[model samples]
Structure formats: C-alpha cells, structure tokens
Target chain A: MKNLALSLLALLTLAALLLGVAGCAKEAKEEKRSESKTATETPPVKKETIILATTTSTKDTGLLDVLIPAFEKETGIKVKTVAVGTGEAIKMGERGEADVLLVHAKKTEEKFMAGGYGETRRAVMHNDFVLVGPSSDPAGVKGLKSANEAFQKIADSASNFASRNDESGTHKKEFGIWEALIIKPEGGWYIKTGSGMAATLRVANEKQAYTLTDRGTWLVQKPNLQLELMVEKDKPLSNPYSVITLNPAKFENSRVKFEAGKRFADWIVSADAQKMINDFGKDKYPEPLFTGDSTLTTSK
Target chain B: MDLIYLGFKQAFIMIFKGDRLVFEIALRSLIVSGTAVAISMIIGISLGLTIALARFPGRRVLLSLVNTGMGLPPTAVGLFVALLLARRGLFGFAELLYTKQAMIVAQTVIATPIVAGLTVAAVQNLNPKLRLQSLALGATRAQMLWTLIKEAKLPMLAAVMAGFGGVISEVGAVMMVGGNVTGDTQVLTTAVVEYVGKGNFPVAIALSLILLTLIFLVNFVLTQVQQRETSSWPKRISK
Candidate 1:
C-alpha cells in the first residue's frame, strides 16, 4: 500500500513537472508575442513571421538566402521559408499554412488557382530545362534538335533514364514530355529515384542515365556530375517560376498579414529584386541561372 | 573514394576552425534532442515502474504497444506529428506547427516509448527475490520500490542515452515538424540532407562528422555517469 502511494506521488510529480514546463512554454510565447505587438507600434517595428513555401531549387541555388533577408529588412517581415518540391509547396499553400508560394509547375499552379487556393500567380523568372546523359551518348541523343526527339530516341533504344519520381516541378515536366510523345516509360531501364534534383542528377550520373534537369541546378552541380548536356534549347523545355499568394478571401483570414504576403509577391518582381536575380550566379556560372524579363509585377 | 577523402578533409578543417554555422546547428540539435530525452525520462520511467511493479489490467497490452512504438519509423512518426499539429488537427489552436516545440513533441513521442520499454525490461530483469526480500525485512512497499529503482539505475540511464541517440540522429520528424528553416529550426541532420540535396557532399559529410562527434561526446559523458559505482548491491546480489 505504501509503495502504491509512493509511486502515485512520483507519477503526480512527473505530471506536474510536465504541465509546468508546458505552461512555461506557453507563457514565454505569449510574452514574446505581446512584446512584438507592442514593439510594432514603436518606430523600430518588430518583425512578424510569415511562412514562404518555395521550391528546393530556389533554396539550393542560394537565392532565397539573399532575397529573404533583403525583403525582411525592407518590410520588417521575417520569412520562414519551407523549401520543398513544387507539389508539396503548393500543398502547403493549399492548406493555408503558407502565406506565399514560389514554384515552377505551370499546370499545377493553374489548377491550384482555379481551385481558389491562390489569389494570383506572377511569372518572376525563366530558366530552360536540359536533358543530361552520359557523354558516350548511348542513344546518340546528343545535339538533338528537340527535347521530344531526344526523349523518343532514348525511349526507342531503351537507354537508362533517371526520373525524379517525387512529383516535383521538374519531375512533372519530364512526364509531360513523355505524355506528349505517348510514351509510358517503364522497365528496369527507367530508374525512379524519389529524390531532389541534385540527388537525382547524382544517381543519373552514376547510372549513366538520361534525366531532365533545370539549367540552374545543372550548371551548379555539373562540376561533380559526369553527365554531359544531351538536349537543350527546346521550345517545350522553357521553365518559368511564379510566385503566388494564399487566397485570404477564400480562407477568410482577412487580416493585415495578407497585405504582407502581397508585399512579398510585389517585392520579388520589383526592379531591385529582379536586378538581384539577374546578377545572381554571374561570377560562378557562365550564364545566370534565371532571367528576369517579366514586365508585369503580379495580378489576380 | 576520392569524394570520401575530400569529405573527411573538409570535416577536419571545419572542426579545427570551429565553423560558426556548423557549431550553431550542432547546438540546436543538442538542445532540442536533449530536452526531449529529459522529458521522456520522467514519464517513461514512471510508467515503466508502475507496469513492472503493479498488477494492472491491460498492462501486457500497454507493454506490447510500447515495444511496437520502439521501432516506429521516423517518417511515420513525422507524418503523425505533422497531422496532429497541423492547423486542422486537435491541437491546432496552439499554432505550434512547424516550430522547434513541435519537433520536441514528436521526438518525445518517439523517445518515450523506447525509454518506457527499456525501463520495463530493466526493472523486470531485477531479481524478484530482491522485492520479496525487502518486503520481508519489515520494509514498507514504498521503501521496496525505491530500492528496486536504485538497483535499476544503470539500465535506466542507458535508456535515457538510447532515447537521446534516437532523436538526435533522426531527420524526418524534425524536418516535418520544424520546417528545417535555416538558422532557426534546422539541425545537424536536416542540414546534412539539405547539403546532400544540393550535391554538396563534402559539406554534408562534414556536418555528419560533427554530428557523430557530438553524439560521441554526449554518450561518453552519459556512459561515464551510467558506469559510476552508485551501489555494490548488484555485485553482492550476483554472488
């Protein structure tokens, strides 16, 4: 009986301690929030955080690192970027967990907009996708005039092809080309690495397979990969990235934070941010990863 | 092979130079995983002691459930947490999703079961004779329970170490819950993943080396505490 009581006491102590810690955490957050609320009223406006759901390509290329801080400094909004695949990023935006989205995948973005998940989408920059393969050119796909022709030849010969089967924007584009030619690629030759662009490229390099990749990531990672550029400058391979704000009117979050979200969409397309995009990677790569040529900032 | 060599070279350089980014990430990993293990130790040890000492209904079922949870994949755990803390979930009102706190909650959920399972084994493994012996010696059941706990201290400490090791090295749960935001929620494991995804193998390997070193330091300290001579009862009982 004594042991039971003692054990009960121990359990109670544990419960109390857990509750105390949880309470303390809540109190701390509440205090910080109150402080921020107060500080925002003063001259030095405190930073408010908003989630920015963007693609891994933007982050992997080290673009957001520069852009986020600059935007924060200009607008006093701290952007917590969640760099995921375009599909997942849009999913986050759809769930209203994100304030804004920067992604590629025009088809998916259009569907998202049509579904009322986003208010607007604006083209921020453009970069072409390239098909990379072994330098030996097993399918003789090198110097192909079109992406479809190269893909058709590779499919005909059953040459190894690496697919980033994770439903990323790049992955979707690869399938788009396959569908355009009515080729349902399968078998052991079609390697599906459910990984990011850089990882898939490495797998393609090791397996000596053909894979579609954005020019920016290809240029940045080409030093380590043995895969040579197989097909380029294809009309259908032009990759355009867009920024979209969450549909606050649809979600019923008619707060001022929606304005902050719009501000980000505007700031990215502004002359200053566009200039940053144009200048990015110039010192490292022969050509910039993305081109900022859009005249319109953003629209519904 | 050459890449591995380059990775080690880079790791050593960063270690010797004490890179700010590497150390900052390591510190975050230690704090987040450490707090999680500490919380788990309390709840798990108590639950394990009760299950081991008392004859409660459905105790066997609970034990098996904990055992199953011990092997829960980090990704599955990540998904579970992502749902619970998501704005639509039960605790969504707290708005704790995609924060360090959410990472802690997921890790605690992960580490608690392992700690509890191990604690059950440790206490049960203690000679049943010791329990009866204490009760027969004019000792109250409460005193008997304390004696048993003292005897099982070593394994319990090992349990805490296991829980720490599990959470610190885990990537998926943290990535899902913490958002892997650089300089905020990003820890060593997610940093490694991000670097690898960027094809920066050397930096990734270097971060992994730092993680291993941090784990070793933590385990060494914990092992020292676990191995220290608190009592000679176990030795005497063996004889």
Candidate 2:
C-alpha cells in the first residue's frame, strides 16, 4: 500500500513537471507572437502574392505596410515583402526570387542592371540621410553645413561613431562621404554594427554614438529614441530609392510577375503615392518623410 | 563544380582562421543544444523512471503516447513552434521566437520523448533482484530507490547522450525558432543548410563533417558506457 502511494505521488509529480515545462514553452511562443504584432495583419490572398525585395528601413518605418494594402486594394495583388540589406535585396533580384527590387544603392543597382538581371529601374523617391548623435553633440558636428564637413569633424574629433558595416545603402553612402572627404575612419572611433537600420540605430542610441540614418526611419523612430539629427540638408546626404524589375530578358520565370511588379513601381511614384509619402509622420515628425523627385539624377 | 570547389576552399579557410562569427555561431549551437539536453534529460529521466515503476490506470496508453512522440518529425515540430512563436500565435506574448531560448525549447520538446521512452525501457530492463535484495537487507524505500537509480545509470546516460545527438544535429527546429540570424542564433546545422542552399558547398561540407563527427563520438561513448555497465552487473540471480 505504501509503495502504491509513493508511486502515485511520483506519477503526479512527473505529470506536473512535464505539464509545467510544456506550459512555459507554450507561453514563450505566445509572448513572442504578441510582441511581434502578428495578429493585426491579415494573411496575403493566395495566387495574388507578389514578392518585393527591399531595404529594411522601408519596413521598419511601417511605410511598406501602409503602401502595400493600398496597392493590394486597388490592384488585388497582395505583396510579400522580403526586407534585407540593399546588397541582399539586389541578390534576390538576380536570383529571380523577388518579382521586384526597391533599393537605394545606385552603383549596386546599376551593376544589377548592367549584369542584365534588372530592367526598367524606376526612380521612386528621395530622402536625405541625417547624421544623428547625442543631443550634447560631443563631436561638435551638430551645425555642420555639409555631410563631408560633419564626417571630417567626426573623424578629426575622434568621437565615437557606429557604422552599419553590413554593406547597406546607408553604409555605402557613409563610405562614399568618407572617401570624398579623404578621411580613413580608423582607430577606436568607428564601431561596426553588422545589423539592419533599426538595430543599428538602437545600438547607436544605446552607445550614444553618432551614426547616419535615413530621415524617414529616424523621424518614425525619433520619439522612442534619445538621439538628435545632427547633420541634414546636404547634397551629399541625399538618398534616393529606386525600384527595378528583374529583367525578364535574363530570367524567363521572372516574366510572370513582371507586370505586377511594374504596377507597384508605377504606383509608388504616382502623385497620390508621393503625397502619402510626403504626409507620412507629419503629425508626429512634423516633417515630410520623403520627397518624390523621380527626375533627380543619382551621383555616379 | 568549380564554384563548389572554390566555396569549399573558402569555407575551410574561414573555419581554420577561427572566424569570430563562425565560432560565435558554433558556441550558440552548443549552448542551445546543451540546454536542450539538460532539460530533456531531467524531465524525461524522471518521467520514464516513474512510468517504469508506477502502477497506474492507463499506463499502457501513456507509454504508447510517449513512444509516438519519439518519432515526431523535426520539420513538423519546427512548423508548430514557428506558428506558436510567431507574432500571430497565442504564445507570442513571450516574444521567444527567433531567439536562442526558443530554439532550445523547440529542441527540448522534440528530444524529451526520445529520452523518456528510451529511459523507460532501460529502467524496465534492470534486474528486479537488486531492489528485492535492498529491501531484504532492511534498506528504507528511499535507499532502495537510490540503488535502483544507481544500477540504471548506464542506460540513463545512454538515453541522455542519444537525446543530445537528436537535438544537436536537428536543423529545422533550430532554423525556424532561431530565424538563422547571423552571429546570434545560428547553429552549425542551420549554417550548413544556408551554405548549401547558397550553393556554397565547402562550408556546408565542413559544417556537416563536424556535426557528423560529433554525433558519432557521442554514440560511440554511449555504447562504451552501456557496455561497461552491462559487464559490471552480476549475471547470476540478479536477473
């Protein structure tokens, strides 16, 4: 009888432990779902999904979500966005995994075009990259007249700065300005953060280090962050976003979605879409997120 | 084929150079798998021992259920875990998806049943005489319990190692849960898959070779441990 009681207790205990452990696992998964906001967005309609390869800033700023549904409602074409660094996005275009590519790096996009993997590269919109840092402006670059000046001040002052280090569009621009300024960002002042725009921003915010970011994402993420835009309105800081359809000439499978991608690319540059971009974050940011200057040429 | 050879060569140089990123990935894999093994062994061993010794209604049903769980597919586990941890799932409140902890949890879930069923069989195969002898010698119930556990140690260890082998080489669960984030939650197996998918054969081969070697070493050790313990057991009457 004693043994029977002991065994029953043991069984109950084991059952309890197993149930408890399983409960924790279930709870952790549930928590992540809630935090990632998986409930609000409806699943894409079958047979109407279009894959868009693009940069992280567009998604991180909640811009694409706003744009995709409007396009979907109008065209009945659901969009599936694969947000990555510009480098990876271009690669996706080359692989024909993406029906369309919206990226900011000009030279790289040209390479994709020259390689015959991309067609009809459309200039969608333009936004300027801003050098943001602690409000104190420890590097004394807060009022710099130009991006090169700000970068020079940063390098000369040897103040801590974070680099995206991920070969992203922003990283390419930063390297460009550095090269133009004839400054080698060496020593302990430069920290490499191999992450997306939002993550790098967070890291920079936490470290109180200076970093360059698109005005759109910065405006959206500003309220929640502590950094201030230190440099802006420079010609060198101008960042333009372009959409390129995977060339059907090179990839035969890419033809099926080519028209669908063209519709989206065309929609993004339409006057209506431009107003949406222009008015985005006006209430919170009080400044336009992007300006549609499709005719503006990129620096080679 | 030429591209494959170059990729392989590059992968070798990257590994031998002790690339910090690669090491970071390997370390995360070890930590995640190690945690899974520990969690599985603890839950599985206790449950198995209890199921072996306990006389309860529906015991046969419980054993059958556990045996079924042992064969759960890793991809299915991955899908369910991804769903549960995804932003839309009920458990998304914990924000565990795409994190190392989530990967460990998924691995443990898949590995636990294996440990439990194997351990039950191990304990069930132990000689009944050891417990009887301990009782006859006037040992308390707790003392007899210890003796039984000690005698079954070899099989339990083997079961634990088997569980480790199961989790360490699993790709789908880790990939789904970890998001295969670079320098964060990536593991050897997932990295292997990623490289292979990218047509980078050398890195895939290198990572695969390492995983295969580790699994073989674990199984080899487990066999040796089981053998030593079996040989040490008394053959006469103890059965």
Candidate 3:
C-alpha cells in the first residue's frame, strides 16, 4: 500500500510538472491574444513599442543601429527590430506580426501593397547591387556593362556562382537577371546557400565564386572577403529600400502599432533621416552604403 | 590558431565583464534547452520504462518508431513545428510561433527520442532477474518497477546527458521556429550563426567556445551525479 502511494506520488509529481509548463504556455498565449485585442480596440492608447521587420543587409551594415536609435530618440518609441531576409520581413508584414517593414525587395513589396498588407509605402534609400567574384575573374566578365551579360558569361564559362536562394532582395534580383537572360542556372557550379546576404557572400568567398550582393553588405564585408566588385553600373541592379506600415484595418486581430508605424515611416523619409542615411558609411568606405532619395515612392 | 586564442580571450572578457547581451542569451539558452530536456525526461523515461517492462502487441513497432525518431533531423522537426505553429497553421490561434515556447516545443521534439532510445537501452541492460528478486521480496508491482528503475539510474543519467546534449547543440529547428529574434529567441548557437553570417568571426568563435564550455560543464555535473556511488574512495577502502 505504501509503495503504491509513493509511486502514485511520483507519477503525480511528473504530471504536475507537465501541467505546470502547459499551463504557463497557455497563459502566455492567452495574455498575448488579449493584449493584441486591446491594442486593436484602443489604437490611441499609444503603446510605446513598435516592431520593425527588416532585411539582414540593413542590420549587417549597421544602418539600423544608426536609424533606429535616431528614430527612437526623436519619437520616444522603442523599436524592436527583427532582422531577416526581405522575403521573411514581407511575410511577417503580411501576417501582421510586425508593425512596420523596411525591406529592399521591390517586386515583393508591390505585391504586398496590392494585397492591402501595407497602409503606406515610401522609398527611404537606394543602393546598387554589384556582381562580386574572386579577383581571378574566372568568368572574365569584369568590365561587363550589363548584369545579364555578366550572368550569361558566367553561365557560358560554367564558373561557380553562389546563390542566396532564400528569396531575399538580392536573390530576387539575381533571379530576375537569370530570367531576363532565359537561363535556368542549375548545375554543381551553382551553389544555393538559402541564407542571408553576408553568409552567402562568405560562401562565395570561400568557394572563389561569383555572387550578387548589395553594395552596403559588400562594402561592410569587403575587408574580409577575397572577392572584388566584378560587375556594377547596371540599370537593372538598382536596389532601393522602402519603409512600409502594416494596415491595421486589414489585420484587425493583430496588435499592429499603426500610429507608431506611421510615425516611423514618415520619419524615415524625413529630411534628417534621409541625410543620416546619405551620410552613413562615408568614413569607412569610398562611398556611402545607401543614397537617401525621397523622390522614389510607390503606392498600390 | 590566433583566432582561437582571440576567441577564448574574448569569451573570458565577455563572461567577466558581465556583458548583458551575452549573459541574457546564455541564460535564455539554458532555460529553454533545460526545460526541454526536463520535459523530455518525464515523457521519454515513462514511455521507455513502459516499453521495456510491458508486454504488448506492436511493442516492436513502437520501439522501432522511437529508434527512428532518435535519428530525426533537427531541421525536419523545426519545419514540422513551424508549420504547425504558423499563423495560418492549425494551432495558429495559440500565437505560439516565433516565441520561446515554440523553441522549447521544437527542442523537446528533437530531444525526446534520444532520451527514450537511450532509456530503453539502459533499462533493458539491467539484469532481468533483478525484477524477479524484487517481486520475491513481497514488493508490489509498483515497488518492483521502482527497484528496477533505481538499479538502472546510472544509465538513466546517461539518457539525461544525451537529451541535454542533443537539444543544447541544436540550431536549425530553433532558428526556424524561434525566428532567432535578438533579445528574445537568440540562443548561443543561433547567436553564433548570426555572428558568422555578419562575418564577425571573432564573436562567433567566442560564442562557440562558450557553448562548448557550457555543454562540458553540464556533462561534467551529470557525470559526477552518475558516478557518485563509485566516487567514494574512502568508503570503498573501509569496505
């Protein structure tokens, strides 16, 4: 009888522990749901928190460090920046998990806006994508004027090309170039990283292959990489970053900080923020990482 | 080589200087993985004990399933959990995706099979006569089972170690479900990956060293616990 009691106690203890964890998880989920509901109903209650989903390049290049702090100081709103690929950032926006999105994938952004995921979209900055490869220039397309021509030469020579196959902005641009050239690049020579720009750059550097990368990330990673800017000055290689505010009405269940997101969007294209973006990376490199141009704005 | 040395130095500095971010990330990693191992231990040990002692139809198939689960890839588990917890997924109503709880769930899924498989092996390794002897002593079924578990405690500790090791070192599943959100879901391994992605090799190396040291320290403690009976040299001499 005593042994039965002890065993029962042990089983109960285990059960209790499991229940405790499950209870906590359920409570947390409930708390979040309730908070989001409240946030939607009382949008003017003015929550101090704003969630910004953005591309890894912005984070890798330390642009968010400067821009976020400046915006936070100006508005007294804390920004929680989630740095991911542009594709993931846009997905977060579509899901209403983020209040704002700062991304570089124009095509994806247009689709997002057309789907009514974004309330406002404004171009904040621009940076060109450069085709980087080992100084060996195995494809021998260093002086190529067009990205498509360079890609063709790489395909013709069957030189190694590392692709960030994560549907990121740079990856999409690369895909565009390939599509324009009508080349379905698939071979052992084409390596798919399925990672961020910097990681893909490292893979390209290690493999001594060519890759498409934003000038910002490239400039930041230049000192460490063995690769050089093999192709640039292409019309199709222009990379522009835009700040998008998630439409609160479209996602009534989400705790979207519509007011704070709008403030951030306006501040990003404001004169001071534009100047800050324009001046970024001047000290360490020959040119700034991004050109702040408020002239380029896209809407649905 | 120099980078390795620099990594150690940086790790020590980060530890000693009480770097808030590093400390937070390490603490979060411990809490997340530790809780996962604990939960897996409960389920795995119970299931393993049942499988080892109980006689039932399809037991062989169940054991085979557990064995297969032992080799399940972390990324596959991560993807499964991600799909389940995604906003459009079945349990999307819970709003658990990208949260620490989601990370725990993914790690638990990855660790449970390891714990269960090792546990089954450990329990099976015990002398079958031990169960008979315990029952002969007029002990009840529950008491006999308890005695068998006590005899198998050391190997069970090994199960604990393996489970902890499996989840602590895992990066893929956690990265997918947890979203690697800085100051939130960023554990040591994911943080190492992030640093490596940014080409900050020194920081990445430092974080990797910290992870290794953490795993070593945890296993060392478990080893001490597992060998506690044999550790008493003076008691052995007196005997």
All candidates: TM-score of chain A: 0.84, 0.80, 0.84
**Using DockQ as the measure, what is the rank order of every candidate, best first?**
1, 3, 2
lDDT of each: 0.84, 0.76, 0.83
lDDT leader? 1
lDDT of 2 at A145: 84
Task: Judging by TM-score against the true structure, name the best candidate.
Answer: 1
By descending TM-score, how would the candidates be arranged? 1, 3, 2
In model 3, the Cα lDDT at residue A111 comes to: 94
Chain B TM-scores of the candidates: 0.90, 0.90, 0.90
Candidate 2: deviation at residue A156, Å?
A: 1.8
Measured over the true interface residues after superposition, the C-alpha RMSD of each candidate is 8.8, 15.6, 8.2
Instruction: Please list all clashing residue pairs in model 1, or write none if there are none.
Output: A3-B142
lDDT of 1 by residue, A252-282 (tens): 8432246678889888998999999999999
Residue B40 of model 3 has an lDDT of 95
Model 3 lDDT, residue A193, Cα: 96
Better of 1 and 2 by TM-score: 1
DockQ of all predictions against the true structure, Cα-based? 0.23, 0.04, 0.18
Better of 1 and 3 by DockQ: 1
Q: What is the lDDT of residue A213 in candidate 1?
A: 95
Candidate 1 ranges beyond 4 A from true positions:
A1-46, A253-257, A296-298, B217-234
